[model samples]
Target chain A: MERTRAPFAALREALHAAEERTRLPVARLLLLVLLLSVPLWPMVDSRWLRILVLVGIFVVLGLGLNIVVGYAGLLDLGFVAFFATGAYTYAILASPASPALQADLNWWLAIPVVLALGAAVGVMLGLFVLPLRGDYLAIVTLGFGEIIRILLLNVRGLTNGAQGLFNIPRPELGGWVLRSLDQWYWLLVLSAFLIATAVGRMRASRMGRAWEAIREDEDVAAGMGVNTVKYKLMAFAMGASIGSFGGLVFAGFFQFVNPSSFTLAVSINVLSIVVIGGMGSTPGVLFGALILIGLPEVMQFSETERLLSVINPAVPFADTTDWGRQVASARFIVFGVLLVAVMALRPEGLFPARRPQARLPERHESTA
Target chain B: MFWFDQFVNGLTVGSVYALIALGYTLVYGILQMINFAHGEIFMIGAFAGWAVLLLLGGSAIAGPMLIVALLAAMIAAALASSFSAVVIERVAYRRLRNAPRLAPLISAIGVSIALQNVALKLTGGRDRVYPRVFPTGEVGLGDFSVGYIQAFLIGSSVVMMVGLIVFIQRTRTGRAMRAVSEDRATASLMGVDVDRTIVTTFIVGAALAGVAGVLQGLWIPNIRGTMGFLPGIKAFTAAVVGGIGSVPGAMAGGYFLGLSETVGRELLNELPGVSLPNEWRDVIAFSLLVIVLIVRPTGIFGERVSKRA
Candidate 1:
């Protein structure tokens, strides 16, 4: 009797190649769907448009965070600090209510300043925690975030303390001041698309490879001549800059900026988006933002209220007329449960990024 | 006299921080992951204690009955917190043992948020007021005075710390815990039930946090669902300052932070042009954490953490 192998290795390799071939088209199709939705923005209800805008903003934030947490593997529980920095920077420059540093600045000029400031803040925080690793870095970053919030609350002379900044002027493109939901929606969509494209390119660059190495094993990456410190700082700066952009838009949309608005919750929300969206996957981020941010906003509809009440009449409601608000308030609980469930059941996330494949040397016919 | 009063206050606060820090240290020792939800366990403990106190007549109960009620509350709180911690370990942490480091942390944060919101929903987002049970008065020794509750807090904290030290040094489970922390794979190979040991670690830490929660309620006289957040952060600071994963270091760190916030703040204010606000205490604590990490990443009593931790 003779024994023979089934050529399992070659079969697996072929299957993987097929998967890689199929994934690109699916990703492109998802992007196409997203881009095709642009014209429908004006057709949707203003209320729904507002929610979509919010979703777009978070999509940008999620992509930014993916750079650090996904590509770099740094668990930054204090990413909100950068968000607050951007918001405050914009509010102080553009808001008339800014007590001490009111510049009555133009939003166009403020964009560069806010982003640069955001990157600087990121670099500063990055430097402080460079010596730390893993959980220590996380805790330290969290502390840094709290310190910023507390400073905002206490720095009465400059920030107007807990009163916050209000009456921020709407962003302007040339002579037209953007105020309507559709206008902001267009701006957000454009920015989201630009950011997505840039990020996608970055993910394939040498820097992205370095980040991937650092994330996998920092010491080993350093041993392999990957300048871990420089790359980590670059990740922080990049993530922070994009997060600040989210903050800038948030201020413009609401015409308000408060320390309370930029709490740990915001960081958690962005992080949840990145984690749930599939880390390094752009399409996954878009999907994540829709579920985490968009779903909650849509839950505020009266239809959702009716849907809920029919499901369980015993559901506790702080306000009967606005039952949707009550359910929306409990979204954090849902977020929590979803986080645990996702991590335990599918750590790779629902829309995981395609892992980079290493090409093997060609097999000789003699080997068969 | 003012300094003495501050000292007493520091001691009382420090005691609570120490107890919570112990839980952090113990868990970190074995698992090397910060149990971010540990603070919520402490809050649950307080709620459990509050429930018992309410059942036992709350503020109305007096004399010998007060002592019994207090004991019951402490025990109940411990059980509740231990239960919560065990479940968190099983549900949130157990499976992520070999997963990426970030997965368990994210799960823990999720648990923290969920537990906090659930507690908030349960309590109608209102503070659960603890009935004032201890008689109002200060025990004095020639201008150095301490409140009855403060004294109890200090005394019990010391007792627990001593008992824990003894247990860790002498008991079989304690030895297993130490062994697991030292080298988990080797310890398991040596026949230690790694899963059970991890669960025990969580239970012990949570029990201490639970007890501290009740003690904190007695002192503050009110407990809220959100009460655990700040204390949890502070206790983690204490754990880190004392060189995390070291029990004795945790105790030292807690007292150090407590004293610095109170007495140390006062001392700083004595400097020219220094009128520090009360809130600056938090800033000070965090700054201290940053400084320590920069200067001595291993903490005061922490061993060489460059290798594993």
Candidate 2:
């Protein structure tokens, strides 16, 4: 153990040094991110902007999931269920195609309802799995996810049964109709920023400490006078509401809500982003979304075709080679390989969250 | 008569589920982790069996030749599944044994995705038809009857279970596996090669799943890349229902789930205005899992889950 840890400790120190070099203060980093993203809408094409929006959406999801699986130590595999609930809820209330309600609710007016619905669903699921631990919790949540999809597919009257609710209304603030890709991208970016800030604050609060304790050991946390149940429920509700928010945005952006979009794969994708981005780390989630979501979408571009050919001169083009198409299809495969490789080599993720350092009073010379 | 037929169908499907469930039970017993990629290994087994059957001359062979081909296919599938399982253990699991529990599971999910997509790409995203090996026939006893393929499936499953029980009870490697599962640290201290025992467990479990895959292909007559997902989840449910770490428990749970899905669904349908479509089968299985988890977390066999979980 000593021998093995020697090299491991060295590696960790080197990694810490590298992290310190790149680490910017929170305020400056936020400003830098905002400044960089400000140019994205004007500089990139609609397609790229759309992809960035998707990435931003996933970042929000990753952060939300980070609260549950990362900070709270609850591995909720059925997270997509919450996302679906949010999207379906929004569509059902807002879309003209909605067979049941067809309230034609404005998108802004629907926010509180959608958020509350998301939180309610999360708490309901939390209540169900409160007793379950680790893998059991995971499988049950996975079942829940499947159950939601099945319900969406079969519930003909409410969900339109697989035909799905289309013509979903987009968010319109006052007179300005927010329909453009850039507008959606900005909305997502802003939402992600807000969610991240809230999540960071949550991680530092008393509730956050309670969640950490519960995550470490529920029985121990309970013994330590922490109300494990309350904190766990809080974490679930918080995470679920954020996930639903992502779903609401997703429905608005696509102007459609379908059961097919919410599958085990979506849950896995979000979970992967959170895991590969360094579980509890906010920046890690952002980085993860960029690499996992952004890279795949970017690879579909025509420019990437040329880039691929250049990378491997032996690779042919068009029908003879068609490496671009093949690569695009192979993205999930790459994702899986990356997941395995990361676990094998660096299980902490690409950007592991730093533990808050304790501040100590400087030693007085007289006392010394 | 309808109930009887459903019972037989349940048994047939139950046998396959039991086989796959054994894999989950074994791995979970040893590592206390879910191997999410186990389903993909089952998929590989189906493809392997299909390949062997094709090589043996499609659906034309009959009698003794068909028997030989089927045996060969099962062996090939077992080998393929075992190989894949071992690689997964080496690459995805072995290193993460001491890491956070989420790491291996997420990695396993990744493997499942990767394997499924690879199969989709290789097969051009189409189902491969299995050659008709079992002769189309059924034996009847008054009002009761079972198809030839169904009989073969049930019979083979029993034989495998018996063989596994014997192997575990009598073999040195099997003893090692049990010891490791009972207590890995102590087992290692006792001079048992913990790693080898773990690999052996994976091989044994995966082999059963592989053969189950072949059986499913033979039963369904069509095998696809994404074929393993549903059955895999159902079998995992079976494992949990019976008792995750218990072999006999898994077997019983599989049959229980199978019966409930088929006969139970029919039973529910018997109630006025309770007619359920076939797709509801999966829903029943999932609901049963949730109910079991909620009401009796320790499972029917009572594996003392609370302490471990």
Task: Give the best candidate by lDDT.
Answer: 2
Q: Per-candidate TM-score, first chain only?
A: 0.83, 0.87
Candidate 1 has which clashing residue pairs, if any?
Answer: none
Residue-by-residue lDDT tens digits, candidate 2, A236-318: 99999999999998888899888899998899999999988887888889988998898877877878877775665463553
Worst 10 residues of 2 chain B by lDDT: B300-309
lDDT (Cα, tens digit) per residue for candidate 2, span B1-309? 788999999998899889999999999999998888888888999989999999998888787899899999999999999999999899889999998667888899889989988999989998789988779888889679888889999999999999999999899999999999999999999999999999999999999999999998999988888988888888988998898889998999899999999998999999999988998888888888899989988778857664432
Model 2: chain A TM-score against the true structure: 0.87
TM-score of 1: 0.91
Candidate 1: lDDT of B47?
Answer: 96
Error of 2 at B182 (Å): 1.1
Q: Residues B80-131, candidate 1, lDDT per residue (tens digit)?
A: 9999999999998999888756667778888998999888987889999999
Q: Which number leads on DockQ? A: 2
Give the clash count for each candidate. 0, 0
How does each model score on lDDT?
0.84, 0.86
TM-score of 2: 0.93
